[model samples]
Target chain A: MDTCIEKIRTICADLLAKGKVQKVIGFAEGSIPMASRPIAVTSKEDVAKLVFNATCGLNLANYVSDVLPKEGKIAVTAKGCDSRNLVTHMVENQVSRDQLYIIGVPCTGMVDKRKIAALFEDEITDFIEDGDTLTIVSPQKKEKVSKKDVLRHNCRVCTHRNPVVFDVMAAEPVEEQSLDQPFADVDHIAAMDPAARWAHFQELTKNCIRCYACRNACPLCYCPTCFVDESSPQWVGKGQDKTDINTFHFLRAFHCAGRCTDCGACVEACPMGINVRDFTRKLNKDALELFGWEAGLDMEKRPPLDVYSPDDPNDFIK
Target chain B: MNFITIDKKDWTTGIDKSRETYQVFGPVQDENGCQIKPLAPDVHPLMDAGVTVMSPKSVLFPQTQKMLTATLDASIEDHHVMKPVKKDDTPRVVLGIRPYDARAILLVKLNFDNPDYQDPYWCEAYAATTFVGLGVNHPGPCDFSTSTGCGPFSEEGLDVLMADLDDRYLAKILTEKGETWAGACGFDTRADAAESQSLFDILRKEAEKNITSVDTDQLSEKSILDLYEAPFWDDVAFSCINCGTCTFVCPTCWCFDIQDETKHKTAVRFRNWDTCMSPLFTHHASGHNPRGSKVQRVRQRFMHKLKYFVDKYDQGIMCVGCGRCVASCPVNIDIREVCTIMNNYESK
Candidate 1:
């Protein structure tokens, strides 16, 4: 982790000094334990602020679509999922290929802050990742646990540990995990009775406060006016009514249908600790099963929804 | 004030008795966490449940409420004429609410119950409900109620404050509303009022000591614009994603946006919770937005909570230090840090 951080800082400082990029977007240490904040450093002096660790979970690509360079290109430190988002952004014309300088990092996986918080009795001062073990340091004591035990659920099943595209590689790519059943969670829900399934979804969304953190944190949700915010037609009501809340989540997930990369930004950003990824992940599963298309893997091919084939399954349409 | 001791075993029986006169609300544990919800007929509230994930302010100010309703048909006698929505006037008791959250309802009341323009809906609901506060025996890590002009056992806005005393609960009835609730619950045991008061004082002091102090002495003297335009805002606002999580979870963030929805021949006007974090909050029909930048929106949230609210109401900052935002903010934007920065800000 230290070596990776040093390499990224050196490259960022060089880029800033050479004026290759106006800003270097990366992760910075946060005030809380096992959390890192997305930051944009413009000067070479501040390059040291950029650090890479198990806590760097936020997709830096979420900022790429918004941070249009005033002068040169903008450099971003992209993990596997984030790199996929960068490619999606390029394909969607949210940002031109020339406008970005991608520094890809090979991700092992990020530790879930919630999981760590549940374990520690005292305040966690630092999270030191050493190989397969994570050292949790607090005022009272320190404990070491297997890195896989604390990895985010999505990360544990992640297949793309290496960036799909990059201008420069920060480190050697790590080996990917082989999962026989990637959609075990989704299948669990699918296996339930229809009424039970309905009840499960209802229970899942009962706590939704309509904060829109899930929408805003999504890299693909870049509409200047979200459907929830539209007043002319008012596609959806802006209240916590059960129907209105359900409509908001359904449409929001449908919109990301074929375009979502399952980057986990929405899940990470949700304050209510809602498992919103379940909705999006289901969409991803359908996209892959129906069209044999995975988002951001092949830049040459358009999104499944964007392109239609005559042989496409229309049984559901009927 | 009067004191009564209800045995732990009789807690549910008392609440069951009160059901005849009032619908009960209390801290109920769900998969997500503890939240304030209406008690199911067979469910008993966990009186010792730690601080709820969300505040009980929703009891008075609902997340969404219908303010007025009107018919769209032109032929009707009173067509297109708006009438205030009638609400249930049955008294409700919100039990096990934390003392800080109870104080937050009063802070919000300053906005809804302004002398010049009072909101009848909010005022009426507030009048119909009784706040039964539970004093904190052990303050949460993020709770700084002591420094935010409230304390763990502060009885500023509660009708009754219940302190846990192991096998029983010492209920301090402070108002007629509280007396009514106690009477409805069949709380007949009388205790020495002086002894109970002394015990509460000791509990308050110990709980207050658990919370780390925050510097807020200079906020009253600090110039609003000077603190607003301070150079630290850019850094402070950098990591904020402008999501409504903090505002929605907040107990004192009372901003709302009103919209009229018309369908067929019926139109209803509803007020929903809105946050200053969104760009649409300041956007006008002319396509001009005063707070177009994320930094501006972020700055507005803190300024309103810590500065503008303080200056306007002559009350403390509009937060109860419940720590919901601290725990809820996905990016770890701690309000305590921001409060310190603003409180200590000085022109170079």
Candidate 2:
């Protein structure tokens, strides 16, 4: 972790000093335990704030549109999913390939803080990651646990552990896992009857307060005015009616369609601990199954949902 | 004020007895985490749920509250006119509300229960509930409530303040409403006043020692324009995604928007929680949004909480620093960092 951060800081600082890029987007140590914040550093001094760990779960690709450089380029540190989203961004004209200096970081899976916190009876005061061991410190006890135990649900099943595109590599790529059932969670919901599936989705979204953290955190959700916020036409109700909540989630998921990278940014950003990927992951699986396609892997290829073909699947429509 | 010894063995019975008259709401462990929800007949409060991510304000000010109802049918008498929705008016006991959250309810009240105009929905709900606060023995690391006009043990808006004494609870009744609730619970065993006072003081001091403080002295002296035009906001607002997570989780965030929804012939006016982070919060009817940019929306949140609120109310910052936003923020936009920047800004 230390070596990775040192190399990242050096590259970012060098980029800033040489005026190669106006800014270097990276992860900084967060105020809380087992968390890191997305940051943009413009100076060599600010590069000291840069750090990397399993906690850097929120996708850095989401910030590229907001921090796009008008002149030279903006250097963004992209993990596997983030690098994919960056490719998507280039494909979608959100940013040109020339306008970005992608600093690719080979990623280890991010740990779920909720999982770590639940183990201790008291509040967790400190989290130290060394090698493959995670030391969780609390008022009650200080215990070292294997990092594999606390990996986030999305990270546990992640196939892309290395960035597909990069200007410079932060470290050697970690070995990727090949899961037999990548969409097992989706399959569990699919196996249920239509009424039971509806109930499951309804129960899942019953706690949604409509904060839109899930929407905003998504790299794909870059619409100037989200459908939920469109008052002139008002596609969905602003209040917490069950039907309104379901409509908002369903529409937002549909919009992501073939473009979702299974990045888990939406889950990481949600305050309610809502597994919104349930809505989008189903689309991700369908895209892969029907179109034999994965999102953000290629800059030249358009998403299946973005373009229409006469040969497109019509079974679901009927 | 009176102190009562709530024996651990009697706690469940007392709560069950109190529920016969009032709906009991408290921190109950859900599948996700601890939330202050209506306690089912089988459920009991998690005495040390810590600071709930969602606030207790929803007890009095619901996230989506129906304010008015009307019918579109022209033939019916008193139709097509918005009429006040019949309120339940049932008394509720917000059991084990944190002292800071209790104080937050009063901060919200300043907006809804003002002299100029009172919101009947919020005010009537507030009038009906009993606020029973629980003092924190071990404050969380993010909690800076000590410096933000509230402390772990502060009792500004509570009807009764209870202290967790390991084996049992020592409840101090401070109002007639609290006394009535206690009586209903059969919590009549009294503790000596002086002894309980000394214990509370010691606990409060110990908890305060654990918390970090902020400096806001310069904020009162600085002009609104100086803080507004300060150069630090762009960097502060950079990572903000303009999501309402921080505002919605915040106990002190009291903004709401009213909308009338109609189905068939019936219309219902509902007020839902709103946030300064949304572009539509300041959007004009002519499609001119004053705070259109993400930076502008982010700036509004901090300015309102730290500067405008202080200048308007002559009170401390609108934040109690319960640290819900600090813990819940996805991008890690720390309020402590922003508050410090605003507090000590030497505006150019």
Candidate 3:
């Protein structure tokens, strides 16, 4: 991990010093334990702030669309999931291929901070990831745990461990694991009766304060004026009413029907800890089953919804 | 003022008794995390449920509320006339609310219950509620209430502040409202006021010592424009994704946006929780946004909490140091560090 971090820093410094890019968007040491913040560096001197670790869970491509300069290129540190989003961004014309310098890192997995916080009694003073083991230090004592135990739910089932696209590789590509059932969680929900499914979704989102963190965190949700904000013909009422709340989640997830990359940024960003990915994952399952398509796997291929096929499923259109 | 001792054995009975008269809300562990929720008929407040993921501010100022409604039918005589929504002013009691959170409500009151313009919904809900605060024996790592003119055991906004004493609770009934509610619950075992005060003092001091962090003393004296134009804001705003998580979980953030939604024949106006972090929060009708830049919006949040609110209200600051934002920020953009930078800034 240290070698990877060093390599990222060296690449960023070189890019900036030689004026290959105007800025390098990367992760820096976070204020809290087991967290890394997104940092923007324009100078070689400031390139040391860039870090690479298992804790870097946020999709750096979320910032790429907003930060990419009009003229000069900008370097970005991207994981496998982030690279997928960058590919999606290019396919959607959010950013140009010429304006990006992709520095891709192979991700093993990211540890869920919320889960880890609940496991520790005291504050985690320090954390070190070595191979498949994570050593956590607290005021009380040091404890070692398997990385598999703390890996985020999305990362646990991830099939993409290596970047789909990269101009520069930070480290050796990781072996991708094959999953027995990719949509096991979604299937479990689908198997439920309609009434039971409704009850489950209600209970899951009952505590949602409607903060919109999930929408803001996703790389795909980059609309200038979201449907919720549109007043002329308000799609969903901005209130805590059950119907309003349910509508907001349903529509937001529907908008990303075929575009969602399953990066888990939405779930990770929710303050209420709402597993909003379930709603999005169900859409992923539908796209795969109905259209035989997955998002962001290839830049040349358009999203399932973006392109219309004469043979496309139209059972519900009537 | 009198202090009442509530026995551990009769805690449930007392709470149950109060449930008959008041709408009781308290912290309960859900699938997401511990949250302050209105207790159902069967469920009771989890007294030992630690710091809730979301603050209890929603109890008085809901995340979304209906302010008024109107008839949209043109055939009616009084059609299109707006009418104030009738709000339920039923007596409510919030049990086991943290002292810092309770203090945060008071800070919010400075905005909602002010002389210039009173928010009827917030004021009515606030008046109908009784705040029973629970003192923190051990503060969280992010809590710095002591330095921000409040503490774990502070009684500024509480009617009754309860201290955990092993098997029992020492209820320091501070107001007549508290006494009436406690009396209804049969928690009237009187104890010496002076002795109870000393006990509270000891607990307060011990809890305060655990929280050692940034000080905001110099922030009150600092020039607002100078701090606003400071170079650190760009860096601070860098990692910020402009998400509403920090503002939503925050107990003191009281900004709200109002909109009217009309059905075929019924029109309803709702006020929902809004954050300055959103670009649309400041977007003008003509689409001209004065705070269009992310840096300006980010700077506005901190400046309003630390400088603007202090100068406007002559209050300490708009924060109660509950540290919900500190703990819940996705990127870990800590307020304590930002405060330290502003407080120590020499205007260079």
Query: What's the distance in Å from true for residue B324, model 1?
Result: 1.0
> What are the clashing pairs of model 1?
none
- In terms of DockQ, which candidate is strongest? 2
Candidate 3 regions exceeding 4 Å error are: A1-3, A120-128, A137-143, A313-318, B73-77
Deviation in Å, model 2, residue B71 alpha carbon: 0.9
lDDT of 1 by residue, B212-292 (tens): 778888898999879877998888887778889999889998889998888899999999999999988989989899999
In model 2, the runs with Cα more than 4 Å from the true position are A316-318
Worst 10 residues of 1 chain A by lDDT: A117-126
Can you tell me the DockQ of model 3?
0.66
The TM-scores, chain A only, for the candidates as listed are: 0.95, 0.97, 0.96
Could you give candidate 3's per-residue lDDT for residues B152-209 as a string of tens digits?
Answer: 9999899999999989999999888898889879898998999999999999888888
i-RMS values of the candidates, in order? 2.3, 0.9, 1.7
Off by over 4 Å in 1: A1-3, A115-145, A308-318, B73-76
How are the candidates ranked when ordered by TM-score, highest leading?
A: 2, 3, 1
Q: Candidate 3, residue A155: CA error in Å?
A: 0.7
